[model samples]
Target chain A: MARNLLRAAAALTVATLVGCAAPSLQVAEMGSFHVGGRTVTLSGLPAKELVFTPGAPPLKLDPNGDFEVEALYARYTRLSNPKAKFPLLLWHGGGLAGTTFETKPDGQPGWENFFLRAGYDVYVSDAVERGRASWARYPEIFKSEPFFRPKKEAWELFRIGDTDSYATDPARRRALPGTQFPVAAFDQFATQAIPRWGTNDAATQAAYDAYVDKVCPCVIVVHSQGGNFAFNSALKYPQKVKALVAVETSGSPNPDTYDFSRVKGVPMLWVWGDNLGKFAFWERIAAQQEKFRNSLVRAGGKGERIVLPEIGISGNSHMLMMDRNSDQIAALIDQWLARQGLRN
Target chain B: MARNLLRAAAALTVATLVGCAAPSLQVAEMGSFHVGGRTVTLSGLPAKELVFTPGAPPLKLDPNGDFEVEALYARYTRLSNPKAKFPLLLWHGGGLAGTTFETKPDGQPGWENFFLRAGYDVYVSDAVERGRASWARYPEIFKSEPFFRPKKEAWELFRIGDTDSYATDPARRRALPGTQFPVAAFDQFATQAIPRWGTNDAATQAAYDAYVDKVCPCVIVVHSQGGNFAFNSALKYPQKVKALVAVETSGSPNPDTYDFSRVKGVPMLWVWGDNLGKFAFWERIAAQQEKFRNSLVRAGGKGERIVLPEIGISGNSHMLMMDRNSDQIAALIDQWLARQGLRN
Candidate 1:
């Protein structure tokens, strides 16, 4: 069946990406967030459940897996505005957490503050590891899609062997001791911590679900790595999603690589550089069904793509959004979003 | 109309970029190129007659003009195996440029070479000035789509406004006073020329057409800006396009901002970041559109967004694909593509 499928499509796939996807489980949960500055705290917040902490809101998750769930909301200043849509969950990239959309670098303008000032409600969260959180979990590289199958057949499709296990191998343990720390850290980050912080986290998922059920998000704005989490969560609870704006993709490989790709018709943007974009090396994996590329074509989402060399951003770092000329990035995105016909 | 259109997509997608009928266009031009160390002589290159030379490739409107074109192709080599299905121009990002598929760093495997070693024809060329040349006649931004009403609309979509004006901007006045230079040369390359280029130009178009006509490009591996060009270009020639792998998108906004629901179809990977994918910045623009975030929800595409806190691509510039760590990037693209089942 696989060979035949390839012969039929690869022979003439004016629009099909080769070899990608597998059905998996779709998990959903929710949690409450401590909303920050915004107008109409009630409206800006996604339509979900928010339970105020009886006393002090616990920072750490319950060790025994018992944790109270609540919905996060914004104390937006412009609640009176009837035209205001429900505030959204504005997530930033990694590094320092907390600086909501309301505040930006050097007080120039924050995504939160700008929206709030414009009569829009927003909930911002920093993608911080939250203390020893980054290291606590025993992250494993669980294959959402089986990576260890008939290698020869799938090898041409561009699958990786047990690449990261180099450090753990007993034979090479002495030769590559330094590789152990970062790889283990990465594994944990990808497996345990990510699911927890992302929509997959049982408590956080519950809280997010509660919020979504309450306010009914008008849109979700995510940047960098947070963009993936936000979108992944939305996929888990697609019915609760309205729209998304992914700033700079970090990991948007194949949909089947994950477990879900259904929606009640949501709008999204996959931002990238000029000509082509590869989230962590598209050249490596783009051969398989070319997930985002092939699927969109098959689905018939004839949208426009923007590829620029660098909108005046020249730096040597992982953060392109925060480049020296970030204004260009910001202004371009704003102008484009404004063009999207989205309401404030 | 422009306002309404922008309102629809949430971003100004001036598009339908393409070349016009010109008798000067010819077939099968050949040339030799030495880039990133490898030197190969291309034979029977398509659109050879359009090579930008003194007079061989004449301009569309100007008889005594100079113009040239380059073909574009990309393929990934298995980091584990050099000999594999080296499909050329078979991968790409949706909204970014075409070159985003391969790494831009030297001593690194060019995706095209990867395929070449893997036994596939690789055709790549430079994109600049105009489809038909005499760089003077061609503006920095060319019509990457088909000829449409309101030429500005297409330009707006691609976000290359004031092309005629920018061409005359005195900022980068060539050398001394008054003398002018092509806008592509202004980059602080620290030298008179730069080797890294775009997946555009006549040569690329011809190559794309040829690939479409023959193998049917099952996977379109695009990153960053190439997404825009690839999406629109594929739109113009849908028969030639199979599937789309639009990595971090920057061009797509809401074709209509108010209508957050209607999106063109194509399976998509909406990768997002902490902020907007920095493309270009200009006056009157602020705020970043979570492009990948928003795009995932576009009307039709089935999208899986992956957000990572850190790409761990050290010393790598976002103008990646050519920057350092391209192998890692390629590995990821290859992995994604493999999942899609387009190994060949």
Candidate 2:
């Protein structure tokens, strides 16, 4: 009787402590691409990829921000590549969102044409505010996220973009309530969308489970703070993505400085602007770049900080979100992929 | 060396699983009210006394479903008993939201008149919609709360108005966004709002703490399904709210009935309606009421199932939220309050 009582007490103790384990997530794969100079071959498209279905409604941009626009990519609808070494997932930088990977620069075909042509099946989405999804969709998508506060305490306040990140037009800001808090939007993306899109969200989860179930060696090439999206998503869903290329982007404040207790691993590439600090204004990100990289490294991630030297013009790294330095960045990514034995 | 390793392992395990013990909620008393035959009071008010601040923007209800009225006692800036009971934070029923407590019964005042005249401060907010704040300011009032699903799932699907309850909503036949598998909105409420309004929400934790730093006998009165809100909020911030009055409500579906869980400890009251249902509706509630009451009883909380038949009217309980029956219900509440030994 005494032994039985002790066993029952022990069992009750464990149940109270663990309650239930966070469920394991099974990630989906959207196949890989090959990067040959400029012409890209596209492969294995996960039918449910976050793209406008061909002949589907054109992606609507929040009317408030001049930064947003969605053009239905007719070709993306039929693109598919199976049995590739790695699938390409397009990630956007903070303050800017959308599938359109065009950076702010002259003579660049935006990363959209860059990756799509490189034969890599790329998937892109405006995390909440910046891109195409209606702003009204927010309160639901970020259902369980807490208001990230003491943000002044937990994180180094400003992220990829700050005061300058706001839309100039009052109408645009009106269109997106998310504008009220841009950084909160990013945190929601990493903590909410990552688990949900591929696994947690019921609607998206089923699509993921049916298509990309655990197959890895995928690449997350993110622009800006979308760097966190790629890294956190991969970290939280490691089995789904392997190598990552953060194109002209700095590391997110999650892995090292913030309470990302909700997110956890994945190898990463820290492709930051070589002249991130050149900007007279929001040059603070450059200061934290080293700490960001070191944190990811400390947390069992393979991260490299890439700050491209001068884009065609002498400017700051912030412009990289819309910069025209794809060919150079693409090559660097190609090199990274080659080393990872990832296709294309 | 082996003992040290074992000790380190045990400590790590405890730290990871247990998390910090939820801080004890320091509940204090504010003021009281003798109403509807019962006397009730506020708990966890910021000043250890019933504090009322005036001068809020007036309420607006031009919407087709809601009637227009000045909620501020003929639009008087604002008034508080100062020594009155804790404010009754009212939330709208599921589909209908904040409109649930509006007292527009053709002539007499709504919740505003009933409570204000009675000397208790009332906070009726449109927990789901944003624009309503100027007039109704209910809800997350958390770091950022969201009492109901963002777009009013409860109102559209489970709405129990003067005529309908979740039981009667034809839409209930179809699965709602968050309800497809039958999880209670209560869980979603706690998961989201607690982070914002309760001590859990990082943004508002300090505010919630500071606000409730003094004494409170805070009494939360939730009508209909808002009971879920009252119950969950009290569970998460028990120190902030001392007593919970679930007027005309039963807890949401629990794990024993479905796959959901029940909240622990808050006292509850389930007032039945005579104006509702064909005799069958009340019978259904009667049938379900026992199980609901039994569940709370087993959880170590006191509860009661009051029927309108107990009063002179056959079923006046359903009229409790309106202007007509407010006084009677108020009297009964006064009686219950006196029993608490809480006096103003």
Candidate 3:
């Protein structure tokens, strides 16, 4: 568990850059849909589909006597690149949806584009109760009202700057020197922010697992809180996931109890951003991930960690996909995918 | 100096959102320029001007036998909004250039547009030795060679995540859950990275002051390291700056002995991001800024601290201007300006 395998392996990355080739791009298909869950009885209330039409009235059609509340919203963009070996499934973190991989808050193309350009058939999804994934009423089906993330929590927890800085007026908000987060586009970043409840994790995990079952035999790219779901899913269906890329993920399978040996076939990678030591909360999170990765390797599974700075790349935040060099980071993944033979 | 003003500001800030009014906008003017510096002699060689033209050839012209090395590169955008306010000058943090206020690496319109749309002419500048601002050979004209910022240093110092995370693989990087930074675009952020030398601070500060002098009676928005230049400029020419808005500024006027009353006539605003306590480095920075602000207030200057979180707008990083909600932050500044009667 305490091995510094990298220093001696010679594979300990020194310094390098991802590919910058702009291949002939072609989009095969792009659209969105709902996945997971079925109707269940809720106090004997009937299950119904509610439809709202713009410039028109709302309508409700009841089919089953059971309530449906856990279907997740998802969008997939597949490229017609003949060089692609496997489709890449993108799972976003807590309080956010597939938008995390779509267009940036500042209007730039997201990882979906980068991966597609790199010959990936990409699938982006909104977990249950996030983004396009509609949520049921709280205190009824949800059991608890959703708590909105104030801007303060983000400033403190996200490592954007000192927590006290965000407490200042918006005009006075100071970014840490050399910070790569597009501070000017913070409002745009917040547009992707949604209300999240601690009580929804179980439901979210279930829906995500179902998503994996449906989109198996594909590579997985998970971010932040999505890390947990990806880890759990890979454990459940190892053969389906050829390779796993976890970006700034916070969740992992319980290292003490989980049998990581099952995931031995799946090549796993974990990427991190700049300043981790600044935030006390991330210490435990980092430790958790390290334990999980170590457990996998000890069990004969392959795993690698790439700290942006250690590799000579820096200034990335938790939202690396939206960072200025997101394309470069994607290219790094592309390179890794090729090495793993996950790329054609 | 250790006062927790936010906790006491319950009545100071309630729940309120920045303006979201998208006004009819028009581009009145846009152009770039070089500002400040005098010709200087280096060694025994005569100074020469070297110019490079696209699709043509490079030209060197010797005129005054003196070379100008530290003039900065600047871009100005003036919008034709009839409901105009005082022009705004945006000073970026250290190691960054005018691009900080221009288009985001993610391709979103920058704060320059938001300010222009809000009826303020804006000037974005690349300090000397940064961006388009040309540099001279070290030990000849300049004293020391520039030092490049590695990826690891950026990750830790910038507060993106833990160093261990970045040291993993690029794909394995894990952002803290709930962070507002665009981690995907980290490579994009790295693209802006350049070599910085500690010896150049004075020259950079001098160039910034000169730029302010050239564009006087304008509102100033300074971030991080730019805080030093903004404070010094305001102190020297308080009359020229109708108002000063320092965003998460770490540097300040010499609080111990400087004449704190000289700039009392100019209205000032100090803004901060969230989580100062998390980063130990920021504690002193926050303290420095707080001490300076208090001294200014005691000197009869009108100033206030706007903490983004204390006001319910959380999740902003040091680079608040490039954040998704940058426009909202700008709107807050706009509102404050109107209150100060800075509007035309």
Candidate 4:
């Protein structure tokens, strides 16, 4: 018995070392690229002498030149042995970059790792004017100054707390009851937010279209503002889009104006988290999406919605992908994809 | 003996499964933030209607608004059990973002993974007007329009080939004999290059200063144009900066104008690749750096230079980190860090 216990201890040590040392997946290919933007020229601007470094002589700076703006950047990781039928694309929302799907603020493995482990080639994109997709000059190329989101606004808008619950002091801020979001990491989440423009929706859509043209026959998972782009892309290229999964989509196409019949063959799933009914803003957005979904179903399209609280999961914020039960949600997504015959 | 062999096979199978299932490291914390940009307001721009989606009516777009511009973006990964005494910050060069240290154009793991595996926390950054650090309005806030680098220009400028070696046709372009850069992935490397403004150097330097102030008493690894910022930063905050590593630094302070004595106590390393003598531009740059290095050493500074070819490691281009022998060079840096007493 003593010998058996010693052997068990030795086996446990080896197992622990192996578990900490190995990588989660074997990556076959990984790289990044930019797609879709036009070049613009600016001439007749004045030249100036500027000091680039301290104690150095000023150098002449020429202002007239041609520039490239509004391009979309995408980074992809293809697995050595993928189990899915098609590649997966993860898109982020307003004021955020492709980092939305990366490691979470609380140091947890995000959906990117979860999906990669589940066996899919994942492509995460920084759309026009966001992240590595550099922005254009405002009032000339971009047509407007960029807008910034304050921390207070994010605290309320993300459904983490009621409007009155937020305070200047962290200790005073009260999150919704049983919130799944890692409230302690709220400041960390805020760091991912960047300035966004109100006038570049058309430019952003064009870039997303170009991205879809470059890479298609793939599945798309979008959140918030990305919903409009993914929805429009699927409508425009139904044959290329295998499936669409939207998490708390902030906006959708107007069903009365757009043709839902164009995407009858495409399967789509809409996911919503808990405490959505606590605010009128979310209620209005939900009503609009419900109307759009109803129209699509009537037009013979495969559209489905999953409300987390109704299905026994609770206390999730709008940023559900970063929530505590994020893995559970990812499992549901994997199960849904398999049911749709997406498994290899 | 047969039973013992059977047990061994079972152990091997278990190890293999565990190896493929675990992550390389346990992360203690990971997140990102933006730093150093002033707010500006723009007015009197024309309002326009934007067609955000196909078959939908145009939405009104107001161009007048307050804007935030010229901020730098930084992402960090802190290991649970760090072996290095200080965090490592990786800064990129002109026309490139933090992606320079990520996956290589050829799909092999880049320096980010290499140093992470070496047991140090890593911080990667996008300097002002690059990547997630969005650009400002040209001829207004920026004072110059951006400049784009043509593929042929990058081919010659990066020292992958001679000026006469670049061609419009891929098959015709010739790399220098025994080049270590993955010539086949040349086109892929071009994707990371973004438009840069010549006039924004001051803004860029200011942002870098802000970054250093926020994250200091740290080690810095810089490449190309990043050389100037890293050098200036070290000179200004010598106590905070433990060491500086410059890889193929394209620019440096004039030893006649700047004082190198400020960094006398800080250890520094200047790394260079092969075939630098093939171009007069590179020769001039090398002379400047050599002068600066000599001045630092004369000032009782801990300065060292490593020419790859001199060390029997040849065939490297300006982008040594992305070259095939990148891991070998990383091992060299690791050894240097150990020698500096940075190993925990």
TM-score of chain A of each: 0.48, 0.49, 0.85, 0.91
Candidate 1, B257-320: lDDT as tens digits: 4232322444445433222222344121212224433544655544555332144223322233
User: Any runs in candidate 2 off by more than 4 Å, and if so which?
Assistant: A1-78, A81-84, A99-108, A129-217, A248-267, A280-283, A295-301, A310-317, B1-344
Task: State candidate 3's DockQ.
Answer: 0.01
Best candidate according to lDDT: 4
Where does candidate 3 chain B have its weakest 10-residue lDDT segment? Answer: B10-19
Best candidate according to DockQ = 4
Instruction: Tell me the tens digit of each residue's lDDT in model 3 across B1-120.
Output: 123333323212321211223323443333444566544544454444332223344343322222446766565645545255567898888655555675554545567766665568
The TM-score of predicted model 4 comes to 0.72
Q: Over 4 Å off in model 3, which ranges?
A: A1-24, A43-66, B1-344
DockQ (Cα-based) per candidate?
0.01, 0.01, 0.01, 0.15
Estimate every model's Cα lDDT from 0 to 1.
Answer: 0.33, 0.37, 0.66, 0.79
Chain B of model 2: TM-score? Answer: 0.49
Residue-wise lDDT of candidate 1 within A1-344, one digit each (tens)? 34433432332232111111111111111111221111111112122222222343423211221111122322222223423444556655532223323222222333443343334455543232221111111111111110111111111111111223222232332212211112221211111111112212333334444445555555676655455556566666676666666655444534656433364355566544321231234344223323554464455542233333443222212222322233344344444455556554
**TM-scores for all predictions:** 0.29, 0.31, 0.46, 0.72
Expressed as tens digits, the lDDT of each residue in B1-344 for candidate 4 is 35433443454354334334534455454556677766556667666665544556876655454455667888776777889999999999998899888888787778876677667889999998788776665565687556555566678889899887876566888999889999987766765776687768777888888899998889999999999999998888999999999899988877898788789988999999998888888899999999989999999998898887876779998988899878777767766788899987
The sequence of per-residue lDDT tens digits that candidate 4 reaches over residues A243-318 is: 9998899898888987988999889999999887899999998888888889999999989988878767799999
Clashing pairs in 4: B180-B315
RMSD of each: 29.7, 28.5, 24.9, 9.6
